[model samples]
Target: MLAVAATWSRLAAMEFDHVIIGGGSAGCVLAARLSEDPHVSVCLIEAGGGGDDIFIRAPALIPAMISGRPRINNYAFLTTPQPGLNGRRGFQPRGRALGGSSAINAMLYVRGHPRDYDEWADLGAEGWSWADVRPWFLQLEGNGRGGDDWHGGGGPVQISDQSAPRRISRAFVEACAEAQIPRNDDFNGPEQAGAGLFQVKQFRQGQRKGERCSAAAAYLFPALGRANLTVLTRTRAERVLIEAGRAAGVLVRRNGRRRKIAARGEVILSGGAFNSPQMLLLSGIGPEDELAAHGIAPVHVLPGVGQNLQDHLNYTILHRSRRRDVVGLNPRGLVRLGRAAGKWRKTGEGLFATPYAEAGAFVHSRPGLDRPDLQLHFVIGIEDDHMRRLHLADGYSCHVCALRPQSRGSVGLVSRNPADPPRIDPAFLSHPEDLATLMRGARIMERVLGAQALAPWRGGRLYPHDGSDAALAADIRARADSIYHPVGTCRMGRDEMAVVDPQLRVRGLQGLRVVDASVMPRVIGGNTGAPAMMIGERAAAMIAGAGGDGGAKAIP
Candidate 1:
């Protein structure tokens, strides 16, 4: 390892006001926001190349981006065999590009339930309540719905309605209504209950048409010309350099060369939950025993560095359909896709403009719950095993997840090498209550699919093999997996085990902070991308000394 003095000398010629590790969703936002000051120099380092492929820009190619082996833009990590999942190893596909998962995700723009943020406040993350964080959400969103108390009209991120929603998609929402679930025009509105179509991160009203608005597109690319900001792609951060109890710099590797980048103001880790905690542990900031086992000397024995891992585990229910227009793997669907592509090239308004899971719902497992515990994603295509398998028949699938899982897992170091993937253990369904909730959700979804509103599309049940709750439970244990949302590894709180404090600063360190999904005290009740970007916005305000922190000094 390079000594602090040596590292400082090497980077003396090019020190930055803020060195942000990981040019993912949070890092891009931070780099964009902080460089706006003009006086503060910002550096953003990304492990993957600039995510600018045509496939990345198209909203309909999400399956191709996320469903496969590790590629140039994907970090396909496999979890340790999950006991809760019947010894099945879960496949996790995190974006390895500049925009992170935002570049590859389905582009749903959900803010999650307001109660999620309020619960963060209750769990020692003061000033993170729905009331406190709502403004930040508005500040980051350029919602096509126009500026309202619930949304903003002019911001970096574009929130728009689906361009060419399928008739089957509308039927799913109507089916939910037939099953007694109310129709919600806006999931981010006053309440989160009910079923509706999801708004996405695509261009709503522009010549750009149906292009995706990822974090890089929304925040990073527009700010590229700013002299104060420097973004380095395909550079992997190896460790955080701490000297005399303060974060001084970062050790990184690019093009097979190791170098240190000094941060004059602060070193912020914007890596997502999996990577952020792994970086901490690799840099000797985790549990003493774990570090010693890896032959790493502990710098800060924060046992909570990789603990409290939580993710939304979901199971999908597939049904066959007789409709020929519906997308599938058959020759007719391929021909339709080709025609859609051609139409997209000209009009940008066709079947190619929509994301796969076009509609969704949030409902309770039982009556009188404070909030909905179950979430649904209605896909217009059959997405079995993350679309790794292409079903020949035209069909649709419904993904149901227990919004807030009770099981807690961890991400740990497999080796000292930064290039090696971290050990992930989401421990899906370890908690009995989680399984019960999922079973209830599956039952509720069955009713919705069976509703008369879907008679035109529904053919026959093709999943779980049987409807018995016992068989469903067994199938869940066998087939349940992540919906791609993982958080809470480096949870923010005031407890002794909390990795970061309410201000998002590492509790036992100075001049260092974590501003990503890892700092969530608990995973939000909806998709995590929007919440992750919201955290980035909030972090920028705190760093610029212009936001609330519940009395904690946010900046060094």
Candidate 2:
């Protein structure tokens, strides 16, 4: 053990041109793109094992990783008790491996409404307008449907149509259409307000077709053989080593030993919403009062380091399924799943390739809305409380979430300990407007589920409630939680409260940047995985262009 520790300590002394703190969605992209130059050395540090497990690759096995029992590749962190949720602490499951949440998410490839980015530009995030960021989205997408005005043909992340969607999923889309929501085959196309099956982040062709196309699979693994890139897994970054007010390196722990990994060019934090802001606070680069309270000497005073936390608060309307084809914990369902697993092993086309929330829609909760304020995810299983609470009967669920929530929460330090989980407070539905919008969305979903298209499969409504506004409001408060899209904790803007500039460089500090969903000024209207990757693509361009010496450098 001493010899092994000595070898690791010596390897840690080696400096790299760029050292990324989190090997997540954006970190994988950054490592791949930055190392493309071949002259610059890049090191990616991940706190979990390599994300190449069979459970991660198989889309249908998502529950195995997400379920916190065995805690496969999931961080499975829980948020502080939310007042809006009747003081119930919501479950916050983030991927702990190289691909990050993208490795364990439902695999939906949603790019959000264009106006989400336009709003960011309007809010002082310069160069982040819809027109400016669209190209980056296109550049990173490899859609199986081929490139058009809104998509790219060949890129790192593969996007494909669901290989074999369940019949119930199709019925859900039809029911949405029957309830007056128009059918939209392509949600990522010109309009996002409609119902249809979702395109997933999965391989569409080749031997790995139908497998989850996580960031590690699409970007990092392909670049692993590059001489300039080094990936260190199960390595925890303790704090950023700031020297003379410029970020110099990171103090990390591996195998219970501490070592400093020098960053000759820049240090990037892509630790998603929770960990990214935690990293800033741990380094004494956040609110002065918070840092002082934790007994950590202040390195930089950025009051907005962990503020403006936002997430999509979702409420579900569940119904027991009359048919046996849907996913459940019954004997018949398990037998079917066993057979499906066998088929998946032979050919990557079966129930095993399913991204459970197969079909969904985006619709306005009321008239006069410019864009879809509500998003619905039609799950083919009975997902009660992030699938932690299981039911014996087969059922289906429809999740209704307010896309642009007005509520804002925060992430804060517990004791300046990197090992300790940060206090996460998404404060879902804290705003009166958010609650009202979600209530309206729930009514809409109830109607869609009642439509004739789903009647054949829909059984008695689970947790049946009287059709009253007051009853619906109570249900929402009691059961609402996040759909796993957390963002904006380390928001980027030119305002005083901004942690990073529009170029993603941490304000009031040099040689440090944040390139993850946490830097979003506002959470988008859809899943955050694709947008997080886009941020990485845009940051790589900014770093390459700003580097006058042909190596990565902090932009002034």
Local error of candidate 1 at residue 292 (angstroms): 1.1
Model 1 per-residue lDDT tens digits across residues 363-382: 99998989999999999888
lDDT of 2 by residue, 173-242 (tens): 8999899999999999999999999999998778887789999899988888887887888889999999
TM-score of 1: 0.96
lDDT of 2 at 272: 93
Q: Which regions in candidate 1 have their CA more than 4 angstroms from the true location? A: 1-13, 70-72, 549-556
Estimate the TM-score of every prediction: 0.96, 0.97
State each model's CA lDDT, in order.
0.87, 0.89
Q: Which stretch of 10 consecutive residues in model 2 shows the poorest summed lDDT?
A: 1-10
Which stretch of 10 consecutive residues in model 1 shows the poorest summed lDDT? Answer: 1-10
